[model samples]
Target: MVSKAVVSTISLILVVGVALAVVAFVHHKNGTKSAGENLSPSMKAMIDICGMTDHQEICQKSLSPVAEKGSMDPKEFIKAAIQSTINELSKSMNFTDNLVKNVSSSARLIKMGLDDCKELLQFAVEDLQSSFSMVDDNDLRNMNDTEKDADLKNWLSAVISFQENCRDEFQDAPEYQSLMTKNLQDASLHTDNALAIVCNLGDILKYFGLEFNIKPSGGRRLLSEDGYPSWLSASDIKVLALQDNGRIRPNVVVAKDGSGQFKSIAAALATYPKNHRGRYVIYVKAGIYDEYIIVQRDQKHVFIYGDGARKTIVTGNKNYRNHKTQESASFSVLGNRFMAKSMGFRNTAGPEGHQAVALRVQSDRAIFYNCRMDGYQDTLYVQAYRQFFRNCVISGTVDFIFGDSATVIQNSLIIVRKPMDGQFNTVTAQGRARKNETRGLVIHNCRIVPEQELSPLRFKIQTYLGRPWKEYARTVIMETTLGDFINPAGYHVWNETSFALETCSYLEYANRGPGANTNRRVRWKGVRVINRREALKYTANYFIHAYYWLKGTGVPYLPTFR
Candidate 1:
């Protein structure tokens, strides 16, 4: 795919030459050279408004033949051109403006920046389509005769110049590279339309024996509707709790000997199908159960909704001193399209070694809405693809919500129970496959508050938002309220050494609170401080597709963008 600049350059050279020839012919036919072509004040004003006055002299000279002799309505042609240019430019600006209005300092601004950049290109493509639609269809087929030759040349020159300016803006602007990346990879259909119109103008002039030679428009729409490299729509949502019937009946009720029916819950789970339609919902009764639960691989599209987070506790004591990392998990979900609502998943493992896991989810298209995860060190492992947690409470110490997945935690409360010395709250070890896997973590619109505040001498309580294990352990906070317990330096590297800084991509944006001091923020070489335009690209439309699919679930609060 050629850059828009290169195409503009080629088109410019072709159109400029044609304009000069038209001027020569007009002068020859009139048998005298007047002071430039007699351009209407309207045409001049249109040129001035579009910032194309620098080419006013060229337009006047080129339009001489058409002014003297042409059947086409020059005013109509110019109006079409002016309207096209304005529409395109306005659309591009709108996309960028919306991005800056939505993120906070604790938000992950870098990933947001990249996504905004992609959207900008999309707008540009849409603009191009509008530009193409403005070109008169009849003009494309008609050949310019002796009288219309100058008009043909002038119109072609102006259209080419308009396109050239678009090329110039994108090429010279440093930010344009990031924003234009995907479109450049494969120009979208709309962009192709604009390119086609620009190229066709030359052919229209050529039919009149003009000197212009426009290149072919070789654009193709890059993104596909089918779920491919990009996620198009939220598919596979699981609902565990239905509105009226088939609500998940977990068997943890009071039984014959003071012991609840923990085993019965497993038996009830056995009745669930290997894979159900759309989303899966499992409704659990309120109880204090000492049960270790597992949703096996075959139970696809399974969702578990409980009475309430505190009231419905799925707990087991798998402390570091007693169990291995694999065997220590209190609840493990290994099915696809799994979701849980209003449930509490806890592992009472002391903050010594990697022992407890409140919930381990290794499912694609999984979510935990209005739930709670409680533990110390590795509480909730967001262990797989496209996972989300909304309006949930996660309380822990030392890298509690850590994992290697493309997960999103939005509008949730992160409670640091015991702020450790030099320990950070979240450590995202995103195992983004080297140069391949586009995986990371996103924390948006969340609140970070601690149980108690400590003194500075007790070791700065260094609560970094994240540490990047892969080059892209991406984390962000948008519109989040942070308490004074949050450390000023928002992130920390693996070691004091700077080696990891080169690969890690930790960052924040627009956060507020006494703890959100920008002056003391960690100055990592890999991390970046981003603006709002960059953050909005990873919008709810892109991230939480399942929410749109399963919006009716009685989950009280979910992140929504109008």
Candidate 2:
């Protein structure tokens, strides 16, 4: 795929020429300049505003088209810029709508992807409209500095997030490579320019003898450079224990042959220690336990370990055809501080079974170590809060590792199995509804390989990195081995019509292996080449607050990539 920037450069040149023509006219209107002798008031204003922006060329081009039409007031130019941004967003939204129709009409393969696009694009439009309304509100209630600080800055930051979420929504789509990442990113940059200019409204007004006092809009820092979070403080990881042992003691034993305290794991859970500050360990003997298990929310700091992933398997077959994918999991863990090791969670529902989940975690600080999550689709749903998986084998056909949570999968094998006809394999389906929420999928130092069964079906290379189940979905694959089995485009995005592919944050950093070379990778602007500082934001150390939690869990993981 050709770089959009290169393709659009000719157009930008033409646009810039027209803008210069307008600048000449504005120069004369400002009552100065013999062609290019001296800069006028309007030209100075333009420079002043554009100078504060990151992308000066984009700012000038966007404002030039509007400023050429007789308006010289900085305030008016800011409004025009906002209106132009909203117009671009509407066009992008319409484009996505067309994509929904086109993809839906084509081979049924991309229907799900397009549907997700439509939903996310709709949200993007709403967010842009909301941002525009924020400007309108400023016009109505001449905001004090307090309102400007509290309201305007937050809204502008959200506007940036709006663009990002829109891009991320299609991060894993099929046509991800062909999408208009550059155009959408340009639009975002233009809006950011407007934001930068408008944020200085107080200073602008001060020149008119108005007492408009306000400070700079230092953006909302979602993640620190070090990834250290206030929520995952050191104190949060320590368990209240009566004993001084390094690990938790088993409260009950579960075995299939009635050799332990209970025959079923659920029965063993019945005797769970109450009000215990430390972990309650459940010793499960090696056996195939055919049951659907639910670890309720109250079972705090619970630990479950088996002999091995293959030797001690817990399997079920309930699927979305009979139960909700949100509920059809073989194992649902909702307890905070839950840790599982050397266990296998399987949902034996075949490709046709649809939406079967092996393990769905709705817990905080949940850790899975040396485990195997095997299923066809939606295998491991990290539903809510924070979770970590290390040295695990996660296998499935479609959307195997999914959900909306702050999740990190390190030193694991993420396999793409061949699915039922008409369904392509997508490794991750991130569901992040809100823009500001600290939720995303992190695939770090893992192996992205194809399932051997896929070779027989001739679908060993038709797999995607992920697709957005929500608009604000984010995922990063860092220091991982992406096998040659991956599709060259990397992702199978949601819709082909709009710039949905531009909104996703599907990133990679210093990955090695045949498929890790990014020369032919998706041209999606959101698929970025991040540095170590940016990559470490998704690492176990700072991203999941590993320093506070991993020590006690005994999970062998590097807290930081550095």
| Predictions in order: lDDT | 0.53, 0.70
Q: How close is candidate 2 to the true structure, as a TM-score?
A: 0.59
Model 2, residue 94: distance off in Å is 36
**Candidate 2 residue spans exceeding 4 A from truth:** 1-248, 456-461, 495-499
Instruction: Locate the minimum summed-lDDT window of 10 residues in model 1.
Output: 229-238
Best by TM-score: 2
Q: Indicate the residue-level lDDT of 490 in model 2.
A: 77
- Give me the overall lDDT of model 2: 0.70
| Each model's Cα RMSD | 18.3, 12.4
Candidate 2 residue lDDT tens string, 152-238: 444444455445544544434536424746446656666677667666766655543455433357532333343433233332233
Report the poorest 10 consecutive residues by lDDT, candidate 2. 235-244
Q: After best superposition, candidate 1 residue 141: deviation in angstroms?
A: 30
What tens-digit string does per-residue lDDT give for candidate 1 at 1-562?
A: 4786896686578467445543543565647874445644433333332222233333333333333354244334343443444444455545445544543545443334434343334433443343344444334433222113222332222222222223222332356445544323222222222222333444434333454333345322223343121212243311222332444444234232335443344655776754444444445677766788888766776666677999888887785544434346788886766778788989876566554778887665677888999887778877544577888998776667765555778888987765445555643444332222224567677888765543342235556566664444566666677777666677766545554566666656676677556687777765676677776644454443433333444443344432
